[model samples]
Target chain A: MEFYQRDRTLQPAGYTPIYKTSVARSPRQAMLSLQGSLSETTGPVFGQNELGPLDNDLIRNYAKDGDPIGERIIVHGRVLDENNRPVPHTLVEFWQANAGGRYRHKKDTYLAPIDPNFGGCGRALTDENGYYFFRTIKPGPYPWRNYVNSWRPAHIHFSVFGSGFAQRLITQMYFEGDPLIKECPIVHVIPDEDAINRLIAPIDLNGSIPLDTIAYKFDIVLRGRRSTLFENRLEGN
Target chain B: MVQSLDYLKETASQTAGPYVHIGLIPKQAGFDIFENNFTNIMADENTRGERIIIEGRVIDGTGTPLRDALLEIWQANSDGRYNHELDRQKQGQIDERFRGWGRAGTDFDTAVYRFETIKPGVVSGRNGLDMAPHINFWIVARGINIGLNTRMYFADEQEANATDPVLNLIEQTERRKTLIANRDDSGPVPVYRFDIVLQGENETVFFDV
Candidate 1:
């Protein structure tokens, strides 16, 4: 198999100019000279066969006898590489807050009541076509201490694993029309508004199970690029 | 100079956030979804090589521990052969029981993550040179946007560490210490402490890949 060539342009600059604090910690010197070596090639290899058909639903676990209390929703999408090829058998893991804007985590001291049924965690492997589907409740916005009273937009955390460790991605997917998105510090960290917009999932009524759940469609384009003209090449000149 | 027609761009990255453990380790988050969690023991008693424990903390720029950090490690087996198909086919036989991988999340209270596994053997690098015995670490926490990649080399193996191709590439000689784990022989099982600093003076040398 050929080595996966990554396009550097589409990737977020380690020290985002807008998010100035990132400069302090993000590697400046190493990023310039380092390239993926043999170590990168020698990473984890997971097979779909090793995984079993078990719990893939985020709304409810087996111990919880009933459905999770929340606004029932379905999140479906495809995982593709930069060249628009389907990345098959890759693990897609997701976690989110319950519909009441509360997580089932210990450190989350938020006052929101924890839904007895909702665990807000799910895992699914992308099929041969790179498609992954999950049944999860629509997460609610929650307050954080980013400022005095900052509320994070309703979002689901996503972790995707490619063939090698270098291709692994950890990101968040937000709702399409969440008003709180603009106010969120985490979302604002990305300098590119267009790139931030890519994180939001659009409503897909067709994908929703009628009378049971609404649906949101989000497609992850991992390590891909768009065409940009160089400054040296001016068409007018 | 000529201009290239198409240049592919990489996708942007985001922080794994506070709730990463909830998804990756559901059982740890009070859910019994999986029979075994993602960060369970890497090798069993039958596995070959000297058993060792790796304990460390993921600290931020201010030296505060990141309680939410989740770490994953991948390494070659005792015989320097990976559990992967290519390596197994090339190297002839690999220890069937050895998984060559482990994962761990920092304890919410203590903010320390630990893994128990055998010392990895020297593996052949891309150029066929003997690469140092090191474990690849992938880390994600609340503040980290993209997961940071680093390697933990054995501090005792000075000779091997000296010749490591990756370690030699570190231009700043001082920063290399951040990658080496100090051996603690006091414990019943040999323990190696490899604290990874995300920022400030002793930040671990993270790879671009």
Candidate 2:
């Protein structure tokens, strides 16, 4: 059991026709890579009796009477694995667009304004060393049609998993100094500027909470597993 | 295992956009904030074998049908094992009433995506070879900037999809009929179908796992 493959040059470039819906959604053939079997070294565990102590609290999980108007933050990090190890218990999930970029979704017609005490989304899990956090509110900058003024930057959409199913990922975090993450055409279909600076995130005033919330961090790596035998137990799960 | 010149480099993938169902199915975008939601029913009437259903449609490249995708699947349980703890620590069997993982979504007006699960058996692969029953999908949507992986096999297994070492690693035997899936026993159970295209002409073969 030694799987570890994904690094398609740190991905993103499957027909980046300036990200206009990636021009008919990429894939003009030639993908088939294979090798990691047992369905890519197995995945799907998420226990903690299937979450919900407000599942990582997206600012009170879906508050209605008071708390969800803007700038609260948190985010946090860890889930590592390109050999920096620590992938422990993994599943992260997240979602955004409130403080005013709007998106309570019914196809977000934009024009920002839906905060009836926001309900954006959340979920966490990591632990046993691979940390995880959540909290939320900061989400704004949105406007997309991919280019007649395409704006999207205050990101946050995670969705990790990562303890193999080929360490699934689904990214988007960006927020450090967002110059719209350098004019994102979907973050310029990553031709890697250090993999788009590891999807941004920064601002961690020592995991903030000074006068209530404001942190950021955002680490995540996922896709690396080795085994050979540490008393083998079925590829050392 | 030496790698790590300060490891970390993986992140970059952006575009589960058009509000990915307000974050992966927030009660299918109307947000009831998940109190146990993710469904497509991964087996239940006391879980055990044959059942089936699967159905599909992720289509795209002008053929339309993507009602914002979002799939997820993983299989095994109907005896080829895997409810995973490395196959329950090497097959000490498990079907603790099966929930072999599912999560479906597409149908915000029929971009169709069904699951209902069961039919999984034959597993083993790589060196031990077997692997025919298949299943494992993963998809993701809104202009999908990443997350695609595939595999669904089984058109009545046709002699185990012809010695399926991941369909003999496709080297184009008519593009391995884009990972089979046909079946259709007309109703009550066995459906299969499996569409997933994502780009020009017969696409669906995606896997880089």
Candidate 3:
């Protein structure tokens, strides 16, 4: 029942004022660290039965007349622990703007027209090998109100649930060659270049469909469980 | 296990953004796509315990409620047992009907999130001491770069709350009140109001676990 401690240095600070929202939302007091209790060690599980047959296929899940207009691509990756162990059967959810850089959301006032055929959302479950793949259109970079000329890089939002509640993570995946990744204030939150590099998905020609779609590989790593032996459970395993 | 490579570093996080609803809860964003959608209802008629409703708003420094905020809660059953695999093996039995987890997005007009659940019993701490009844909460929203974690303790449980190991960890005794949820028994079902302040004089105590 032992779990590895989270590395605080790897995580972004709460008060990155350049992000604008941090000015009003960042806490003034320092956070308190605690050992993982039962609440933190356990999380809700989503089974295969809970998902639909087309849940992992964004290309056709919500398509009406024709496939969404854009560069068809496959986003494939593995869910692993910090210890490099495969985290199987975890739920991974994704959402993004269309290739035109316009979200279906009503609040998005971006001038880019919304693709009527694109829903821009999908879900997938990792296999025993912790592998998952989804078909989607390449999202377009878009503008935001962070600053006068603040524009987000082409990215996809991902929500992942590991075995433990403490392992729950929500992040954005950027393209490897996207230059905007270096300029976005949000991406600059992490001080380490290596940490930021892990978020970028590299092109995987080996995984690409010959005539149909290109493929990008983005593997996510969650907090790991330590190999410590618990005195009370030594006989159990 | 054959060790081939070093453990990979955990990936950096980004904001959920203004359009988080499109993926996390697509049904609320005008698309009824998910077959099994999660709601604030974690308990049913057969679930044993005192039924209660937890309601609150996430207020910012300017005293404005965040309309885009989303919250998820996880707690033990009324019997003080979690539905998790480890807890199930240790506790032996739990109310299977009690899902013990719920997700709720703030209302567009009201900016309040509510959860219908049964009051949880005392759970054991790491040292095997009795911990006060509380619910673990995880929050994220448009402006939040990383999800925040906090807990809600019942105000009525004074005796147990006084000795709570977790609550006592807060050096500032006055700031501990931020974690307490006030109870209103005037209604049919007891309602506990716990407003989480992200930044202000009454900012809630967030945890780094």
Candidate 4:
């Protein structure tokens, strides 16, 4: 996996304090795509499955262009406490999709494209209520050597929260029956089909909202009595 | 529309009497770490056994649904005092009268991560200024990390607002919208709705600090 960083000497100084968003003195804008009517608000929309993580340290970024595997699809979701309450100001982080349908963040790499527009990774902080969301396109499947002439299903890799090294999860969201599932080597790793269903998000087509502007809602729970079978199989990092 | 708050009148609108205590309860990390960090956290000495709730939702740019994020809040008491080491050191040097500083931790899994603490106090300003009474928020969701350094100004405080040093630092265009606190629609948690709009078209106010 290839990791890249940005330059700071090039940062122009002025009203934008340049350190923290709160202290930005000039040209302060909301980081999301806010589109809506009078009372309601609709936030940001990045490029096709294209957006980088919204870290407070926007000054720095990790590039994925030089990596061997490529589909840089940025996958995102939310995390809530058990009580069905919004914890409001929480942090969410995930890095997947390289462009050629591969991951550049290490751990998982199936060889995909390295999209320039799609940073292949993105990040967003949840609002007041524990509602965390992201703007990225669903990732496509890549062909692997699970079996001769076999390809993986269309899926987006995911991880939850920023407990640093102590907390990091690796799972993939597969679209409904994609035929390739029959032979994908990775999918075969999980012997049980019922278990895979848990991670597979039900298809909720964004018809009225087009793929370019589709909305997928996926929530994650860190630790609680209601544990998913997936966690039972693997431990998050 | 250049309007100021009605201070005394705004204070009149608030439910007066006993001010409450709040605490910070965060989930620890590591295996077997699943043990509730709250049990011992809520019982900490600083919190004084007072239960205060902070609640709100997490949403996206398109007004769509989002879930599974962690949030943290740290601020001063209703009297505008903090329990931090720095605040303690500056006590007499800064503003001997205001204690303004403390931190609380909580998570919102079902669409909202709320905190419970008595509303903070608007600390008297140093070098001739007034500090806004608001809590600082921090969030971490599936692979995202964000921070918002803002204060929840009471909707009613017209006078104190006008002279607020920090609030004044914000541009006139973003000031009004940012300096607001909404009432909680749910149960009587003394809710004040404060939403943070990330970068994009129309965004909420962001600080320069």
What CAPRI class is candidate 2? acceptable
**Over the stretch B11-117, how does candidate 1's per-residue lDDT look in tens digits?**
56788877788888865666566654567478888998899999999887677787778998888887777775546324435788887777789888999999999
lDDT of 3 by residue, A156-198 (tens): 9999989888888899999989989999999988778888888
Worst 10 residues of 3 chain B by lDDT: B84-93
lDDT of 2 by residue, A39-152 (tens): 788877778777888878888877889998889988898988877878877888888889888889887787778988778888888898899998888988977886788888
Q: Provide the TM-score for each candidate, comma-separated.
A: 0.88, 0.34, 0.95, 0.38
Best by TM-score: 3
Could you arrange the candidates by lDDT from highest to lowest?
3, 2, 1, 4
After best superposition, candidate 2 residue A193: deviation in angstroms?
39
Clashes of each: 4, 0, 0, 135
lDDT of 4 by residue, B38-93 (tens): 22121123543223455555444454323443444445555554533223322223
**What is each predicted model's overall lDDT from 0 to 1?**
0.76, 0.80, 0.87, 0.38
- Per-residue alpha-carbon lDDT of candidate 2 for residues B1-209, written as tens digits (9 for 90 to 100): 98647656667667677677777777777768878766888777888888888888888788888887888888877677787666533543778788588887888897898888888887776566668788889887877788888888888779988887777878878878978888988788779888988789888889888
* 10 residues in a row with least lDDT, candidate 2 chain A: A228-237
DockQ of each candidate, alpha-carbon based = 0.29, 0.24, 0.56, 0.02
- Chain B TM, every candidate: 0.92, 0.36, 0.94, 0.61
- Order the numbered candidates by DockQ, best leading: 3, 1, 2, 4
Worst 10 residues of 4 chain B by lDDT: B9-18
- The DockQ assigned to candidate 3 is 0.56
Q: For each candidate, give the interface RMSD after superposing the true interface residues on Cα.
A: 8.2, 15.4, 2.7, 23.8
